[model samples]
Target chain A: MTIASITGIGWVTPMSMGCGRDYKTLTAEAGKLPKLTSRMIFGERLPRFGRLDGYSKLGFAATGFALKDAHLDQWVEKRPIGVIASTVYGCLATDIDYYETVVPEGGAFASPNLFAYTLPNVFLGEVAIHFGLTGAAFVINEPELSGIAGLRMALNNLILEECSIMLAGFCDAGRPESFQYPVEVTPGAVFFVLEKTPGDETLSYGDLDMDIEGTIFFKGAQVQNLQNLMQRCIAVQSI
Target chain B: MEIRRAEIKKVCIVDTAVVTALGNTLQDTWKRLIKGDSGIGPIKRFPVGTYDSRIAATVDDLRPIQDRSIIYDLIGRLLAGLKDIPQDTALITATTKLGIDNLENIRRKKAARAGDVLPSSMPEMVSGKLGLKKAGINVSASCASSTIAIAQGSAMIASGQADAVLVCCADIVTEFTFSGFSSLKIVSPVPCRPFDKERSGLTLGDGAAALFLMSDERAIQEGRKCMATIKGWGIANDAFHITSPAQDGSGLASAIEMALVRGGLQHEHISAISAHGTGTMYNDLMELTAFNKVFCGRKLPVYSVKGATGHTVGASGGIEVALATETLAAQTVPPTAGFQNPEEGAEGMISSKPVYLKGDYLLTTNSGFGGINAAILLERGTNL
Candidate 1:
């Protein structure tokens, strides 16, 4: 089956921001923490220890870059695109703040504005809503692999299930201290635009190979036997 | 493209590890399980006020290695003996609440930490720990998460995506999962009694299990011992309620039927079944109905280990499969610990005694909250 190629890539991570032109530059200078882009929208002194920049702003910036990378901004109205956005932590900072405001204060809250961001997939949903995408919009929760799995599933749909285009990736913007064990926090997102097409034969992310049947050997004398077999295969391949 | 029942050749459980209520190390947990002991105890980690469910299978002080970095240490332990894990081998992680236990702790201390509970971010931490530049983490479909992880890993290998793949599924008990199940009023106050008529509900437990998969040709070349072959598997969605399974077991039965069809077996070929018996009213009943539908009223030995190892959630499928492999290898089926009386409707189908049976085939099934149902067939040796 001819699977889709990741023609467009957009990313925002603690180490880098934007995609394509800016992304290459940012990633080249990696290992630095991303700025608190959400603080500007919500204002400084946001109570949360780990808060990303405003989700909408970050998402819009990433999308603009992705569309440019895919060269699909103009075709957005005509193309049936499947949008899948995933995250381990959604807009948790916004949720916690809204909850506190409503429960402790008991008044009309401006927090409803943040409710849409709480659903981890809202970034993708927002993009879909903005583009009027009538195709499938899926939100998966697979912690870190969400992006890769999303991309794979999208490829499956494009090739096997017959979808035209898929916008898939992972995104998260939260502080490190917000976790049980605090590590330096970085805000990051990566998006890919995939479409079903013949293999480029020249350029690709990497070849995808899958095996549905395999052995799972545990503790036993057979372990040595299995080890020998592995060694022999590699040896023969090398020859 | 034709779907061939892919042949499993070089299977290597490149890594195997566990974190159970008994102890941190796989050796400790295995010792406890082999001795026929229980890890259920009072909830000490968190205060479980007058809620009926107080006892649980809690992990001992993992506090020492609570940092996300511990996952790497655990992986290192699991892969200690393996020699042929290629640098390019895909890493697939399955967990219900990835990194959320830490997030929950932060949330309790400061509500602002809630934003850290997303799933997309967990793989990076794990991959970083494993020194894996290429990996994937899946947290979809609840209890079947790890099972799906295994399935996906196998698929990756079959598709030639990688020479070998590492599949790890882990989850730690947290206030969020405990309280969430508590809110559903489905947690038993005592140890779980899967398939029992008087069974109240499941006892939530936490643990992690990892499995390594490789092609049969590779295994033969490496001389790695092949333990068991994944014959076939079926995955389907109920599209039903988020929590409650479809009462008729339509989705569950379809998955089982597909699994059997894929395994090239009739209902009678199954030697035994490792059920998902969560000990909850709805889940147990739904499973019973589904089993009956698959077996067509035939009597087959069935057992659930939840009584011994509480409901491990996403890890349950892999853990149970591991136990089932042992059972098949040893040709000894352990008695369902808490099977006192079968439910009124499932009396004819439930098995209570630990009957000694020898058969090459075993069927393992798991169900999750989002109406996700998965079934996999395994055979003792490849010839089956």
Candidate 2:
């Protein structure tokens, strides 16, 4: 009997940001990808997010907002928070850049940094290192249903009492169109802070479905638009 | 009012099968393992060029099938006898890189064309092929992927979420796979020597293993044989380094302690141990330290099959567990094939020859790249 309550929501897509301090909601034309630079990721930064890849930068920044929204500043470095992240196309861009470095001279040079992100598990490692999360971490790649899978893994761990609070989210980034590769994936990340209810003092949003006998439990997690939150953040009521 | 489980359920391992470099059936694989045979040799499909490693353990019998048909074929063999999966069974697929070999093909085409890249959601595909209707998901966490997936499967049954669960694990050894480890300098030029003083590093292997799990009641009702029982499981992170493990082995020890607590068993009850034993310096040292801490001066017999299977990556855990279940049933432990001289703090623990099972319980563990570690406790089944 596992009951996962949504305590905090932190979503960052091309359209808007939810559960952040300066929440930004765009108009109806906000579904396109945002041009993200290092400056836009960490403001007033001389060299904040330089070492991080674009794929990891989006995930890392979105997770930061989720963690901060959960008020886990004191607990971030101390407690072991389990993280289950979902991705459709993971590390595609980074793999391209890494392989390009390897093929030119037939093993003449190998960049260890580029080699790090070649595998998808490295993305989970980067996020775990950034947040000091030592709990069980799984980076699942399920075509269209990765977000739902991530939620189930997180809920299973939390219900088993491994961790009271867990961070489950979806992080997807587009690959270079010129490159010939796999399936299609849009660029975005949506993170939710799931807390085991009745133990912690945080207010709950609602209960998440855990009985998996029939329908998909995480089916209610998606939203077509950030219309409600957009109205509060932006001056435009047409959202 | 709160939601609570009525009672803790016993997770039972009903059946298991494997396809490795040696044989296709589980019995055949176990027989060859007991005789201490290694299938590692030079790969003929490609060239090594100037790489650090020259050979790998590969399953040569598997012909190239369709895109996802390899998994489908292996899983079909796993579900051979079972008539009813009850439409509520959980299907889990574990792999490090499902179809990473395709990346090279895309590159050869000038990187300007589209591709039939590996589907990230392979579990759904597997479930569809098997005609399973309830739930499906994929788990990818480096080498520990299948162990974690197996543990999750057992927990789903133990927690009353599902009546049955099937875990399928497979990974192919490719040039792209070889180059990465070669770049890291972790691939041994010769066959791997796990826990030996002269051990250099690991050799990669390609294989697939599947474990069908259900509750004890379901196993009894269906008149199925209970090969083993999943008593406990644990998962933890070192948080020390991205690739390297902690020197003190605290992270792994914590997980061992948790599994013991969960299974309601002590270290003294453990008869045999199936170790990760990746043949690397740090991995071997860290595992020895953790074993010493958990066993507390008890030199339990330890063995690793990597000498024969050659670290199948994500598939390694499932293969190891299948072998462990065989050991539990046979009441004998196979020799650590590549072990000759043992490392310090691991003296007398490495069984260089066939040894009898000491007790009724066995512990299997795996550690992976992201500082991730996982373990599952299996109890010998008497009802089989």
Candidate 3:
């Protein structure tokens, strides 16, 4: 089993954006997410923010908020912080968009900018470059436990001492317009800052635990997905 | 509650299987590799009149199983070679694009398996085939997918989290991928020339590889022969560019240093290296620069198989690991196909002729589009 302290939480949904958001309010809202702007990213102006695809924008915003909430916004040198994220229909929407340009011009019009974001891991790279995180970063896709799996991998990296801190979460976008598959999902992102030990002065959401079998628990209760863990964090914080 | 760290355990590669454009089995591929054969040819899978690159390495006479994705056929062929897999073994698949051709079909208003379009479907398909009760996860880092997956699985076993782990990865050269690389202006019109001064770019390929890793105690209990032992593994990111590598090669150098540190081994302990060597100007240059820094300007033996198999994307690392085991067993490093003249940084490192191994340890490294870099150090198995 492995244990880590959830020092910070950041999420972006249709209803709310930023760290320490109310889970109930987010669950209550049922509408399309507003267009994310650079101003929403903790007052830091990102010149490339407008150029990012929707999926990258959502993930980048959540991670930016996560680091800021954890009081790690400034970097004197490159930090050994890692990021692992889970997705189901990762970059498929961008892929279709990129391919559309290829079909018309017989590959001559294929957008290089769009092709760069075809893989799901590209967003993780954006986060890493912006934060100067030189630790291990990758993306995982799981049908079930989509969010929890990323957390598990992050905790494993922490336990192995691969890095002292890790940012784990899930990021997904709605199905592409031309995609024939029917995948039920909301376009959003959620991230948690996990540290090997709880530091002084920083508020910890709770102790997160995972068994050898990869089963996860938060506050002694089994959690299936990131939403469940978020609700648990909100419930515990309220008390 | 008590805080406990996982006990460090020894992890061994009990078995490996591979199916690539060169051959359908690891033995066949190894035989062709040592003979210095090239599998890259004209791209007949799709029309390339409008594309910059017209050739790629493809599995000959391959048809999609049940009109689904070629991935199924590749995985089936790969899984057929394995005899016994532990029931409790967890699975971790690696692929940048899982059955992406299915999406192309769907877009063209043709019949397709919609579920296969999702990356998660890969693990589902593998779990069903393996009859594994535990769920699986799919890693989707670009070119470095399988390398990271292998390292992750080894860490799981070494940390006592899993006794056995099945790491499988596959990626096919589809029009979607071909066009993407072409648009990026990195696909070589002719076959790739790794480490050559005239090296142009990478050539995509179709392949799949599986590595079954088990803890030393479990492998002994199962009476499985150890093919190789994972001594150390490390992963790092350049954090420089999304698609470009750092010119200084600092990120890759850091990863290599970490691997040596974690293995409790010194730089001199490594005998040779299996480089990523995509043949792209930046990738090959960045790798050579990193090698120079890590080995401290020593002319260590380095070889790449991309010229023979083309760039297999996600399967490149797993396939290279299989070849690494063969290198240890045969005590020889195969020649780099399509290589003649060496680039400036590759003068003393890379060779077009086979080099005999002098030590038991070999280091394999891969870097990808996300600035992701991973290295794994393998020691010769006792039986070998």
Candidate 4:
């Protein structure tokens, strides 16, 4: 089977902003876990582990860079074939705001602005709506593995006669309360424009030698190994 | 690699974990289900003002695990004996609403910025919790998320990609979900009735279910007890509407047909069907139409366990598959609760009582938003 390669990689993490820089640069700048930005506003009630902003801003930032990385900015006017955006946590902010008003305050209506973010796939929807790429648009919620799964799903869709170019990735603007924890919480988005044509671009990312393997019962050790493998793969590619 | 027979070698309900209003474990859930117990109750987790529909099948007292963590702890007490852990396993989680339960609360307060909710990222939290070495997460299509996860995991094994795949599907009941469905007017004040004439709407529930998939050859080689084999699966899109299903049921019927073809069986070969009867008027009607289209009036005992366990969003598909597996293993299908009479429109479509049968094949089907539909065939161990 002809495997799909990452022709372009665009990312927005806490360490840095865009895919213009490689993973190494981002990892190198990985400093101590930042304080929950919400804490500054909400005090003790804020979460300990979350990203800096939210997913939309981060998603757009990443998309812009990834389009440039893939040299598809020129095709932005024409719009691509498909879009698959996966997020473990959808637009939670919108849901929270909408619920607080309607449920507690006895508000008769929900804010249409807030409601716009209600759909978890709205970020991708916005990208499609903006780009006018209407081939196939899907939103998947696979938790942390959403990124890899999004890539694989895009690959499969391309193979199964779904679309030609697939914009696949995962994005999340961390949880509010969880941001206070000791862990590294960052709002990030990563996207790749997968195409069948293997275009001629000097900086083109290689195809992923991917294999979806493992048993249903995974322990801590197995998860760590998978993380290590991913880290190593990114590191090797960087080198 | 010429794709020959797409045989799903071995599928293990390796680890089943659930958090519902009934209980947390499979045993507890089964006990509650057998006694016709209701997980729905007054809304306590969040303040429900004057909402007429205050009932829900909620998982009470679920704390936040660290970001990117394993979900085994949700059913930690039940898994005391299984010790042989695979070191290099991949993790795949399915969920509809991830980590938005509490974040929604904070967002309401406007206490935190929007960016702070990233840690609640469901897949990252689950992967981090499990600490999976190689992982692939899939939200897939709507209610069929987890089932599709299982199917994808099985495909991974069949393709010799991974030795094992841990597929977990989880969702939590939140005010956001309640409100969204309520806006759609699909929430029933009372319990849900699948295929019943008086069926009003579906009551939403939250829970997580996990399973393991490995090759039969590998399992036998390792002397592992082979629970069952995933015979085949089929996935398709309706291309009709975003929320409502196509009335013609062409997409669903096509999926069923493809599943049978993939499993190398005829419609008569299936002993029972675990249906996606969401208790909604349109969903039940469409599913019945699809069933009749496929079976052509063959009375294959059909069961919808949503009555016992409210519609569990993404986890519904996986949980139903687990229930179907148990039913097949026990050779006794549980009766669909609240199924008094078939709907006027679906008269000859649904089965009223649980019929005892001696067959090796079970078919499970799930449909989700975005016109996504999936079907899987599970044959008895003897067939393997």
DockQ metric for all predictions: 0.09, 0.42, 0.65, 0.14
RMSD of each: 11.6, 4.0, 1.9, 8.9
lDDT of each: 0.58, 0.73, 0.86, 0.61
Task: Provide the lDDT at A52 for model 3.
Answer: 87
lDDT of 2 at A112: 64
Candidate 4 lDDT over residue span B1-384, tens digit each: 212344334454444455556676666776676566767676676666645477777766654444311223343322332345474666666765555554564544534333223323444444545566644554545677777777666666665656677777776666666766766678788888898989989988877776666677766666765556677776655555556777888667867886787677899888888899889988988888888889886767777878777888878887777666677777876677767898765564355555676898998999876566778888765432
Worst 10 residues of 2 chain A by lDDT: A229-238
Error of 2 at B205 (Å): 0.4
Which residue pairs does candidate 3 place in steric collision? Answer: none
* Model 2 agreement with the true structure over B147-261: per-residue lDDT tens digits: 9889888877776777789988888776666777777788899888899988999989887888899988888888888899999888877777667888888767877777888
Top-down lDDT ranking = 3, 2, 4, 1
* TM-score winner between candidates 1 and 4: 4
lDDT (Cα, tens digit) per residue for candidate 1, span A80-188: 5665555544455554454344333222232433433433434443454344443334445554332545555555444333246677665556443423424333455
Looking at model 1 chain A, report the run of 10 residues with the lowest lDDT sum: A217-226
- Clashes in candidate 1: how many? 62
Give TM-score values for chain A, per-prediction. 0.65, 0.78, 0.93, 0.70
Comparing 2 and 3 on TM-score, the stronger one: 3
Model 2, C-alpha of B317: deviation from truth (Å): 1.1
List the candidate numbers ranked by DockQ, top first: 3, 2, 4, 1
